[model samples]
Target: MQSSHVDITKKSAYVDAHIHLDTYSGAAQAAIIQLLEDDTLPLDYVVAVSMGLKSSQATQAWARRYPQRVLPAYGFHPEQALPTDAEVAELLAWMDVHQAEMAAVGEVGLPYYEREAAAKQGNVFSREPYVELLEQFVQRAAAWNKPIVLHAVYDDAPLVCDLLERHNVRKAHFHWFKGDADTVERMAANGYFISFTPDITYEEDIQALARRYPITQVMTETDGPWPFEGEFTGTVTVPTMVRDVAAYWARLQRITEQEAAVLLRENARCCYGY
Candidate 1:
């Protein structure tokens, strides 16, 4: 592997566009701190995504502890059942009040995986509630003028794109994205951003995505605490892994590692306004 020209000794040129920092254990977090201090890990910042209101609060705490490195985004994830309307309202209110502190409205999207689970059980469920909840978050993102990190994949991505269009929310990021070519082209045409995970190394599908999307519209992430396979197997997911991911992306895009690092960092800044 070619050594990265991104000199983390002077300054960080890479960013983890999406992660759930609140979910990591204390010891793991300490390891991250040590790596950063030793300049072994060269990441500028991480966009910490929330699962729900409680997770949002904890993520905010992490942000406070690492004020310069951890950026918080509060929202509900779709993997779990939707919260009550009142609870949703409370979450929105919390986000609104802390808009100044947060970076984006994120980790919110339709339950694609849950839908698959329901089908395996011979159950059919409506996505209306998910759409409705996403609408609320989109509206908040618009009102707050904050970028939104989405988990929408495959067929659901089109619907998510519809809502973004309806709401006219332009600064959107689909993290760890997996979708059809048509949808990918649609998103690229709309100038939407996408972030790739470490899977880019071994997953040909993800490699194709990196090849198809313009470098300027791409970023990198570990989605840490969520393990990966390939070269990432068995190792605890950490932000430092992004260095290798960026290098792989550079190879795929036929650009130098430094160029890829700078482009990814700029993409993160543009998406999250950091």
Candidate 2:
């Protein structure tokens, strides 16, 4: 978990707008958190999003331990089996109790990968329940007036957008987004933010997105513990990887890498309010 020894002084500082810090091992988490104290790195803060109640608790603890660097977000990820009614209630109640500490309600959205896999296996995937669950989280985010970090993409993006619109929740960050032109236009028009991961460095589709989407509504993330290909094939994914992401994004947007870094960092700060 050592820092990627890239020289970042040439680039403007940036933030990992979305990451799952709790998913890393204890030692890896320690090493990563320790790097945040190093001023030489371009990394400023990491928005650590949670997977569930236990994950949220661990994220909160990390935030407490490193108050200046870790910005914790609490919510259940939608890729797994649905929680029971009591479990859902418990998570909601716990989130309410720690609402003041959370940077946003996040890692929440409809399950695209899971659904696709089920369909490929000739199984009927029930989406209504997932939609209902996302609605509950959206309602809470609206009530708390907190920004929301989402895992929504493709076909699920429009449905999630509907819930956001219904609840009048505008501060939405769609992490690692991939969707059609119309959905992109809708999200951009609504002023919702989307973050690019290291894959942007080599993925033509992601690069195309960086060009089509408004630069002002964009940010950078690692989604660490989720490896990448291309130039990052063997390296441990870290926050500093965003520097390269920003560099590639700048090339696409016809801007300086430093300028892209600043824009992306500000966009994240504006959306997450950290």
Candidate 3:
């Protein structure tokens, strides 16, 4: 893999606050790990978030193999159908057994996209179960003293905020976040962190959010294997792309790219405790 041309100095590095490493093929995962191991790239760590038990297992394996690069986050993603009661119990048990190894409890929150799609199909979607499940994860994160990575956005953001506050989980990272001004202010007030994807290089809404958001609470992510547009169009999403996000975010915040890279990296380290 070609190294980044971002001119990152030894004083700074980038951390991908969120990514689905388990979604990639084994070969692709190996290639990405190789890039992460490359000192030439200004990348430091990739927080590999899981979709469920299976995904968590895979991510954990990678973390064990490449402890220097992969920081594994374990939890069920909310965009899919609810797992059975027994399955949920099993997953919780698995997470309990591996809690010490996880960076956070994540890829978990309310199902905004799925519910909206259901509504578009003229179907009523009940969010009660997802909310319950999210609360459980939030409770565990609070008890474990771990940051909770979130998929909550828009209207769902406020509700998830309620859970975080109720549990006193201040180290929340809302990855690839999108929300209204009030929610943004609320999250900022709570000292919660949010990450920008490569799309920040082009998306006006995301840029606006970047402008409104406090840079101290900001970080960069790729949510890799999830493609983007603009300059990233047709290119495979990789963790190194966070350098591009940090660069664009610097322009948005009117700071130097190196400054953005250091701030974002430190924010992720603070939030994830890595």
Candidate 4:
């Protein structure tokens, strides 16, 4: 009956922390408002993510529109790739041109697609290309004092951590981490971050993960447009769903949701220098 009825007041500011904005530009602006419209949600900012080199343009534009709220991170996802060296070089050129446009490097890591496993997809799955590229790019970020928003996890998580350590990349956020205990321990010991999305709201494995690690080691995300399926009934996931995830973590950790929200927001800001 009233706006307050839709919004509830929570403690501290809220952040989606990590999201794919370019992929959902059709509803980007409207969704931004919707996610935090409820006073109960109280989102203060969002960390928009780029899934590819080209996605940077749209993502940056949208983030610029909401500079006070959306900070953009750009990169090329290992899930997709170009066919030749020239094409890869073209991508590198694009990154060079837009280096100043992003807050971090991300959504970029190893490929796990079936075709990539059999070489049916060729070199896209090979860590060689992106790993070498990251070697160069990581330094550029350090010179700029920007963090890296990582996508590699599971068996690949350890490798990502290794590179971050070798390059002295201090600010790293691994979204949707499902890595083994050894890897998780390394990340925790190294002070890297892992984000949980709607995936944890229902999945027992993710819930177990939440229980395995302390709340301070976790943050919230939606990985919008990437459905988690337990809920949402096959509907499109949006960054706003991150609110549910924040609450879920608080519940799992047996702390007030508001308290967890505060910690998560801090972690997000630290990763992106917000």
Candidate 5:
């Protein structure tokens, strides 16, 4: 027996923190997409992110097509190979072309997990050039004045932070944060918000991190398409399951579900500049 491709689906009435809807879908219909709402929670919204230069525009289009329910962020994903400056330049041009429609700059950062594992897969991922490319996008974002969604962890977090600080780009959000205590504390002090997923429900380290961090600085996310199974053998994910993330955080903070929901939404708004 073998585990089939993950059938990542959203549960009832939840918000997916991060996802690439373009993965399974294509760019053709990406422009006129209709974001469906979970029947259980029709009022909830989902944040869709672009994987790289290829998909940013379509992601933006999806968000534009459904502004009230979708928040779209654009950028290059670092785990994959770096794209040419010409490609990045085109993306920036696209940004200029549709500045009013973008949600934020995101899905970009050093690939601590994937890049390191590239050795086993016989691939290449040097940090110098990729970092430089990321810096260029960061500068463009700063010039445009939009919040950035980051995909860095641990050591990469500091470098990303340093670059952001040097560039004076203040609105930075670290998704799925798993950096050092000192780094987390520093990020918190700098007013950088870190979001959690359902992983917090089972991961002791995540629970500990949530307990120490200020609720005001902490937020919940689904990171949908990536399900987290706590005690269950194999669980699945969807936007609606974000409520579980909120509940877990609330439980860790000794707060009510309602209060957690309000705070999470506020934190998300603050992070994404919504």
Candidate 6:
């Protein structure tokens, strides 16, 4: 595979702590490839998160293509149907086998948005099975000593927090986090990190969280391939947007964009050890 020409000499190097590049279309994926080769884009490293087995495999391919620029994280997403134990074991074993190339075990957590969908289907969504699944991943993270990226948010955040505590996993990053004050405070106290997406630019609650949470524990993410609203609406989600998100955090925290950018970038590398 050819090495990426993404320049790291730029004033500020940004790290996208969470993005699902495999979820993008062929053209979008090609665009990223071109960006990496052009040396104009201001992206330093991207942590590509997986939704399932196939996503993880595709992510690994990208990581291989851009060894220095792309970091891969593998795990199951919460909103999807829970995989059986055998399937879950297969995925975890695959991740472990590729642990030498893996950045983390991630994109895992409880389903916070499945209730309404379950109601429409005339079936109740059970949390127990998902909890069991999450426990398995958490155990793997602990055993491997790799940071775990989380999809847990809102009311569901506390449950995931409990599991993390039970497993004694300290290196956890809660991407696009949206939860209560108590949960946020506990997470902060426990030394867990939280990152904001482009939504922070217009979302009052996310802005508030940015101000309340210590900047030392904050990071930035595009959650790319995941659309956004407000100013980000109609824009293709990309790592470049993390620059603007850092600026927003700067204003909210009363710091310069350069300072915010550096801190956030370091936070990413610190959490994922990339």
Clashes of each: 0, 0, 0, 6, 9, 0
Writing each residue's lDDT as its tens digit, candidate 2 over 185-255 gives 99999999999999998889998888888777889999997899998998778888888888888888776
Reference-based lDDT, residue 146, model 3: 93
Which tens-of-lDDT digit does each residue in 165-196 have in candidate 1? 98899999999999999999999988899988
Name model 5 segments beyond 4 Å from true. Answer: 1-15, 24-35, 38-43, 119-125, 231-235
lDDT of 3: 0.89
Q: What tens-digit string does per-residue lDDT give for candidate 6 at 41-157? A: 768888899999989999999999888788999999988888887888899889879987788888899887885578788997788899889998899899889999998988888
TM accuracy, model 2 = 0.94
Ranking by TM-score: 3, 2, 1, 6, 5, 4
* Candidate 5: residue 142 Cα off by (Å): 1.7
What's the true lDDT of residue 111 in model 5?
75
Each candidate: what lDDT? 0.86, 0.88, 0.89, 0.71, 0.72, 0.85
1-274 per-residue lDDT for model 3 (tens digits): 1112333464878898889988887777677867867878778889999999999999998899879699999999999999999999999999999998888998899999999999999998999999999999999999999999999989999999999999999899998899999999999999999999998888899999988887778889999989999988898888988888988888877778786787777778779887
**Best candidate per lDDT, number?**
3
User: Residue 181 in model 3: shift from native, Å?
Assistant: 0.9
lDDT of 1 at 186: 91
Cα lDDT for residue 135, model 1? 94
Model 5 Cα lDDT, one tens digit per residue, 1-32: 11122212422233555766655344322321
- How do all models score by TM-score? 0.93, 0.94, 0.95, 0.84, 0.84, 0.92
TM-score of 3: 0.95
Error of 5 at 46 (Å): 1.8
Question: Pairs clashing in candidate 2?
Answer: none
Weakest lDDT window of 10 consecutive positions for candidate 4 = 1-10
